[model samples]
Target: MLGVRLDTELEERLANVARTQGRSKSDIAREAVRRYVELHDEAFRREARRQSQRASRRDTQEDYAFWEQAEREDAAWR
Candidate 1:
């Protein structure tokens, strides 16, 4: 079990919401924590997927050669 301490005002608000919704404060807090963690985990997974996708894109020799040519042209112009 996790113990959390909230500000007095927030605690009172939570209690009012809990009473109005007919749900225990524990239940509401648990669901909120679960959803928060789920969103964060999902965001991590998406970033991992993006990194893997970028890693899968191979840079060919021709691409490197083009950049080299561009750099030489810029150096000459300087």
Candidate 2:
């Protein structure tokens, strides 16, 4: 359960939309909130995936450098 307070102008706009659509205000508000949450959730997930990919690339580069250094040391001992 949630409560929302709207100013007069916005409230009137909502009322008009609700009336034209033959839907209750609560229904419209609920759908709007649901869509908003979904949109942001997807955006958050995309950012997380991007960060993970960047970290993976950094690790791969570090691993390659470490192996290259080890190879150089081995050649020096031969």
Candidate 3:
């Protein structure tokens, strides 16, 4: 068991949710914790995969295409 302190507004809202859903605040808290863990775990995994892919990339490309296009536009504008 755990004891937590909540502000008046949050306490009212939690109580309302508990009554409407026929659940205890503890149950709601448990579900929220579960959801947070699952969401962040998936997020971390995705970021790790992206980092690994970037690490495996041997060479990084410069934004030469954009620079070239900008130069061409500037030449036309002049």
Candidate 4:
């Protein structure tokens, strides 16, 4: 559903590659776009996972600090 304009040389190069590879020009273009999208999606997922792990570590440290302080206060009151 997208309309794109190609220069004559670019069109010729694509046709030559497609012919050599025994693939339709549209098929080759579709595969190229698919690969680009997959690469970007994987990078996004990695960053999100890293952020989640960092947040979990921060929460665990805060919980431990809280309990440690509580224990100190209890010993002082005894």
Estimated TM-score for each candidate: 0.73, 0.75, 0.65, 0.64
Give the alpha carbon lDDT tens digit for every residue of 14-72 in model 2. Answer: 99999999999999999999999999999999999999999877868789899999999
Ranking by TM-score: 2, 1, 3, 4
- Which wins on TM-score, candidate 1 or candidate 2? 2
Q: Can you tell me which runs of candidate 4 are displaced by over 4 Å?
A: 59-78
Q: Judged by TM-score, which candidate is best? A: 2
Alpha carbon lDDT at 22, candidate 4: 99
Compute the lDDT of residue 20 as modeled in candidate 4: 100
Top candidate, metric lDDT? 2
Backbone clash count, each prediction separately: 0, 0, 0, 0
Q: For residue 57, give model 4's deviation from the true position in Å.
A: 1.3
Clashing pairs in 3: none
Tens digit of lDDT per residue, candidate 3, span 3-56? 788899998999899999999988998898889999999999999999999867
Worst 10 residues of 3 by lDDT: 55-64
RMSD of 3: 8.2
Judge candidate 2 at residue 44 and give its lDDT.
100
lDDT of every predicted structure (CA atoms): 0.94, 0.96, 0.88, 0.92
**lDDT of predicted model 1:** 0.94
RMSD, candidate 1, Å: 5.5
